[model samples]
Target chain A: MNSNMKFSRKTEELVNVFQFLKKKEIEFGCTDRQKMEIDLCVEEVFMNMVRHNSTAKNKIQISVNKTADNKIIISLIDHEDHPFDITKTDDLDLEDYVEKKKSGGLGIHLIKQMMDEISFEHQRGISKITMVKNI
Target chain B: MLTIEKINDNEWKFSGRFDASQADKATKELADPSGTVTIDMAGLDYISSMGLSVLVNTYKHLNEQGFSLRLTNLNRHVRDIFKYTRLEQVFDIVDPTS
Candidate 1:
């Protein structure tokens, strides 16, 4: 599954791209629960990038592929280099941030809670995250 | 994705995300107003602080124009945020079923 797409900082387009992922998942004829999970996880990841792409001059590359081992692999690469991966986070300490809600972290926490196998690879000034969910 | 539907001569229900991401679209679509607008949050799933700021700014803008903005149908998640922020007392926050 070789696919590549470049996106801008536009939030609306980002939303549509997530919907496109949902459509692709449906066209693949996967299970209902799996499809919903795929759609939501994809949406959260993309939205997280959108919320940060502006500071990074709107450079985000996203790829989706279904591996031979029955796992949906989604790769998110961002030009912004800060050495942080939100995909593996498990602490949804809403208590910590609710009173003084800080931007750029909440969405990622939510995404980590939903994904299955999330890996981080930062190289050449780019952060690439690969998330695999077994359907 | 924002729209205004006339519920009555006095109240209009607003649906959609009113955040910084879509604030311009929301302001443009809600240009024409009557007396008061009751935003129905039944269809809204999530919102951010930017969205809350947009609502506060919109409330101020509408009030300046003699039209009040009242929020209704705020979901539990959003209500929690508002309650945490002590804004539930400031906003109407009508029941979702209504």
Candidate 2:
């Protein structure tokens, strides 16, 4: 609750959006290792949002706020009835690519593994996902 | 996060963190090593599955081209990553950097 960064975008903007978000995280003093993990994971989640909402016209709101304990909390808010929690995707055999890779499940799995905590919110016609990590 | 030093005769030494974030351009550069190439990962910190995928893909491509792919300077961390993926048997993992 110390601070926040908000962004609005359509699905098309997600392609290279991770690069920008990653740079911003670095600016906030996230360690390089944490930055790399968060950057990769955040990109995956954003990419998922875009894919799931192919016809999404609403701009997503992403906020990054610092917690009292000097941690970073990230939230992605949308207005779609996305059925899955997205944090529960199963792991993949890192060996298989073409078959398993096309599914694109690794990103979510990796995110789940890297982040300390990931949770989603769905109420009042808004879907919000927040990821927290102690930096 | 990886360091590259061009050894004489077009060989290059690679060391440091080579993860998904660091693979794209490194893959491109490694794919075309300019000549016989050697990668030294003794100082490698850690690598992701994506990193290994990149290395395996490059290895396949290089093998087809009849180009010599020299792998040396493997630290314990790098070796463990390869071992986990069973890539230890696929690519040449050498110790002697010479």
Candidate 3:
């Protein structure tokens, strides 16, 4: 089964999306660790959208699907005109000490590390980010 | 969903989820520290990048004032986030039960 949802570009709406993903993970027989990883990836992407496009009153669309090979796919689409390819973000220097480390790029770094695969696309004035995890 | 309990003047216990929604409040509560500050994370279920950022900032601030920040009782999941972010080397983390 596949599910899709739309919510305003507000951080408060993230709770709803998280709850929905948790319920779907259970239905897909995902373990707790898998569910948590997916939740973290979703939150990182959604927060990036909110922080970058906060001035625009756009809606974000999220969809979840399970592939035949037991892969969980999640897609996030936003109407923000600017394209942000998270894959191209600066590599987090994990070796940096806390006094010198920059947290700005940490979220995307976590998402990249947790997800099996991640891709970004911008077309027709819309940006979409897709992430997949094996259950 | 974050709770900060004062164990003493230099120690505090943090419980619950420390996500984006709670980052601001957690930062405000963690602003001040004395010579040494210990944060108990045994009851913490989850912590996101936002929370980690806050903690990092707090660690820097405390260090600047000749203070130290320590964390104890990190569950497996919480420890994993720190390890993934490479924050394990940045702070003084101790396993109180070990």
Candidate 4:
């Protein structure tokens, strides 16, 4: 199954995102745990674009598709071409994070840990983040 | 819809999805937790990064006051969120069923 959506830059659109993902759950046929992780991954990528990329003028596009080999692929596209590559983010030190009580990069860290693969592509002033999870 | 109910002066019950849109409401309800704050996560189905930040901020605030935060009745998924972030070490998580 394959589906895609375009959302405004505001965080309020998260409700719509959840609704979209909930519909995909039937087609994805993933376990409950996997569903939760997919939700997290999508939310993190979507929020990152909304929060960090303040200059983004266009709507963000998100797509979900299931591969032939039973893998779920999620893609998020930022049309504004703000290139913030999450894959290159440094590994977080849990000890230091707790000591300092910092929240930065935590979302990216979770996305990395939960998703099987995360790839970034930039071209023609568009930033696309693709994440995959094995069912 | 996220529901944050103040069960008492030190305990709050969180139910439904706690995502980015609900973070600000959670933050406002969780602000100024006086004593050892206990958050009941029994009815919480989902929590995103922004939701986690609210908990972390509350923990920091309570820790500075010579108190700490406790999370109870977390579902497996929510528990894994803490485990992945290694925040289990900082917050006292209790599983009544276990």
| C-alpha local distance difference test of each model | 0.62, 0.64, 0.85, 0.89
Which tens-of-lDDT digit does each residue in A1-135 have in candidate 2? Answer: 323344345434543455456656766778766765666566566656766876767777667766679777888777786645786565656566432323235456566667899998789778888998888
User: Per-residue CA lDDT of candidate 4, range A1-135, in tens?
Assistant: 449899989989988998899889777788888888999899999998997787767899999999899888899999654588999989888889877878767899899899999999999989999999988
State how far residue A99 of model 4 sits from its true place (Å).
2.5
Residue by residue across A47-82, what tens digits does model 1's lDDT show? 666665567775578787777887788887887666
Per-residue alpha-carbon lDDT of candidate 3 for residues A38-102, written as tens digits (9 for 90 to 100)? 88889889999999888877689999999999999999999877778898887776666444866
Q: How far is A35's C-alpha from truth in model 1 (Å)?
A: 5.0
Q: Tens digits of per-residue lDDT for model 1 on B1-98?
A: 45556577556565654444566666655566666767777666555544565565556567778877788777665565556444454455677532
TM-score per candidate: 0.58, 0.56, 0.94, 0.96
**Better model by TM-score: candidate 1 vs candidate 2:** 1
Q: Show where candidate 3 strays beyond 4 Å.
A: A97-99, B96-98
Give the poorly placed runs of model 4, Cα more than 4 Å off: none
lDDT of 2 by residue, B16-55 (tens): 6565556676777666644545677766665665566676
lDDT of 1 at A98: 41
DockQ category of candidate 3: medium
Candidate 1 Cα deviation (angstroms), residue A98: 3.9
